[model samples]
Target: MTVTGEDSVIDVDPLEPPLCAPLRRDLGWAQVQRMSQSAGHRDDPVLRQIRATAAVRRGTRMTKVLSAAQVSGHLGGWLPYGFCYRACDIAHLHDPQELALLGTDGAVSAEVAYALRWRAVDPLDYEVPGGPAQPGLATLQAHNRVGAMILGTGFTPSTDDLVPEFVTAGFADLPMPANAQLIAYVPGGEEVILYTYQPEQHGWLRLAGPRWRGLLDTLPGVTPDREYVPCTTPGSAKLVGQIRDREYEAVADPPEEFRVRALTRAARYPVSTLSRRAEQALWRGVPCWVLQRDDAWARLRLVRPDNDALAATGARCYERGVYESWAPVGELADHHIADIPYVL
Candidate 1:
């Protein structure tokens, strides 16, 4: 992965937002300092043991991804027209040259299927400049993901959920391992974002706001006001007129589990800073309440309750924790909080 100096064509610093100072008092900072000190000290056997194991706990933060040049170079000529690679293709690319490219030609569907098969063999082994995992690149190359559906004018609308069905059926046709799954996003309306998952384990992952905003900036002509519309059904015949291919099979039903869960059960996890007012608004819609996962972090969904746009009509924050999990109380347990120990 090439690391062009700050003068590169893609000016990263300009794309980033300005940093702000903390608002807390000295005692608040002192508590954090003490925690850090205690965690760093290796005197107690129990603390040391937990810290050792915690080192392996994969950080859930966003991963750096490749730019357009890196995606094309790494694909090594496998790239297709109108199918330029974007950073969104690989959610975990740490280097510019090590992107997990997704082909968009009719072959794109098939290629992604093959990639998933490759990723399924004890997946999570890929991490550039390998550490413990030697086959990280290989594993990364094995899985291809279409982060968001962005087709130009297409022929007829599909009957099968184009994004989801295409992924699942495409993988099903390949000789990939049974464990392989396909995930695709269909951005329809602001209220409804469709997540199609196949092989079950393949679940929906929301793109961070800033990252999604970056994607909009990357595509030259495509602006936020008019992003591509998601194809609702497969083999809609409408797309045939837009493109040349129509051989891919469609699915019987779109995967709706993730969508349902997010609205009904999964905890609301935002990636940007939200004010206290916003946090309260978000809480009113759902039964449980929460702040950011980590106190040091600053995302509105994590800290403040969002307005009516995100939370349901009557939710509230039941518990609070610093730099902890967004766990609600009193209402039905948000299934999303079971794994998290710290509550915010």
Candidate 2:
């Protein structure tokens, strides 16, 4: 495994909506913090822990993720394109290079995946000139995921839920580690994935082995929006694709600024400032309720009898009259909170 480091860059910051990071019970916060600073404080980088897999506790505010330092070329790091290394946004991190390695997904998806990120082992990071491979890069590469993300239905016009249709359509079942599982995302009305989530996310749905070729050409889940290409990794092993779903994309190619990384989920967590406007459309048809509000960038919690988007996703936040997580107003939207709440 080769390790690489990136140069610090300055651009319009795309604030990854804050995620309530998950920690191992045995792994204390202090230890994780120390490890993150020394290594990649977490996966990807400080502003974008892309490789995170965070899960909210069954009934608690706490979320947990298993993250370690990594620095190898990303394989399928992005969900829709070939691999491209991420230049992290590290304004708060002490080391611009060493990020807090947290989980399988990073900060961007932290907002998209509804606080829970999918954790996968990416065994392709190579050490670059300034970026030396971190301690666990090799172990991560050797870890194989065992699930397949066959094309499925979301809100598309015609929902394709039949798995057997794939074989009949000449797409054979690809091999995956017994532990692997497929994830689905609908990025546009015409395609399932096109514009990636973030920089590292350009490598769409990472896969390994020779069978990857057949799968890329034939996956039924893929919309006509993808542009298939051969792998560009160290050994040139896997086949990847670049998404053509630019019609629905909110940002530009090789973006100069950070735009929406996660478009599916709304910013539900409370913050010091409220930015929910009718235009941001943070929620998919779900309207957010103001539990309480003060000045800008103040704390807002989900009070009782608010909304059902949480229940719809089978998730929640507030419990026993306490707010679990919160963020700043500007981070979630471009406007300010206009409501004056009467709390019970």
Candidate 3:
């Protein structure tokens, strides 16, 4: 593929193998740099000069490595919204061990790692940072502490190793695409797919078996025998596409990346699970999901609300059905994932 830049045109072999082998060890930022340079990854000027808005093709698989906290939050019902990368760009780094290197932001974490895998449903919601189209983005990044760190180190532990990082426009929380997967990277470099989201049924289909069922015990309200749990929280953004003169929910399910292991064979699990679990809780008297949290503060978004609830909390709308606010960690009440019944 020929990518044209302002000053030069570079040829990228469509079939060229991965730039490097899977990173084996969890290394610090300084060590990672030395390793990259020693491996000659920094010597390829084509990689450095390559600049183009990666096409957000429908059905393209996207992967976001999650921290241990993020994994717990998601299982506790937090919708994912933030930065992720196209799977193809980092195909060589998909191994569980290699993923740990990326998940910890290269800082080395002794805890278990996790990742979210979903498909691109709409092109409008995704954008490649520092691409040719977003010239000013680089300037904006330079003024921040994150940008300062990047400038001083010449490496972005989370994204720089992999090119063409994409973020959701406005960082808006989006609805979980059907069959979105939650994966666990255990100690022995094994990937345990814990659950798969079933949009049609509005629940998660548990995929883990005997050995890995122990992982479910950690999640509050999740049980091994219960195969599905309701998670129909109202979302802020959804993708709809018209087909055959009718409108319906649109989903991008790339066959290769959207399969599950069943017995001895891998196959696409049909979305027909029934919901069973029932539990709900609130934070500060409002049903909300914790988007992020620290010792002092927790960022939350409303799960389902009416006008009165919105007015009471002073939460601002991020999009339809999505409202968010920052609450003091001490003042907030215990929050739990709501298991509301599915309506449609």
Better of 2 and 3 by TM-score: 3
Task: State the C-alpha lDDT per candidate.
Answer: 0.22, 0.22, 0.51
TM-score between model 1 and native? 0.18
Best by lDDT: 3
After the best TM-score superposition of candidate 2, give how far the Cα of residue 307 lies from its true spot, in angstroms. 12
Query: Which residue ranges in model 3 land beyond 4 Å of their true spot?
Result: 1-55, 94-101, 104-109, 130-163, 241-344
lDDT of 3 by residue, 157-247 (tens): 4434634456554344555766889887777666789889876555678888888877766555556677787663445344343334443
**lDDT of candidate 1 over 43-110, digit per residue (tens):** 44432222222111111111112233322221221111112111222333222222222332222221
Among residues 3 or more apart in sequence or in different chains, the pairs in candidate 3 whose N, CA or C atoms overlap within 3 Å are: none
For 1-344, candidate 2 gives per-residue lDDT tens digits of 01112542334223221222334466454543444333233233421231221111111111111111111112222121111112122112222112212222232221111111221112121111112222211122111211111111100011211001001000011111111122112222111122112222233333323433332333334432344322243221111212243212122112122133233435211122211111111222332222323354423322211224333322232211111223344444333333221111
Flag regions of model 1 displaced more than 4 Å: 1-59, 68-123, 135-218, 221-223, 228-344
Taking all chains together, each candidate's TM-score versus the true structure is 0.18, 0.19, 0.53
Evaluated against the true structure, the overall lDDT of model 3 is 0.51
**Count of clashes, each model:** 43, 57, 0
Q: On a 0 to 100 scale, what is the lDDT of residue 97 in model 2?
A: 19
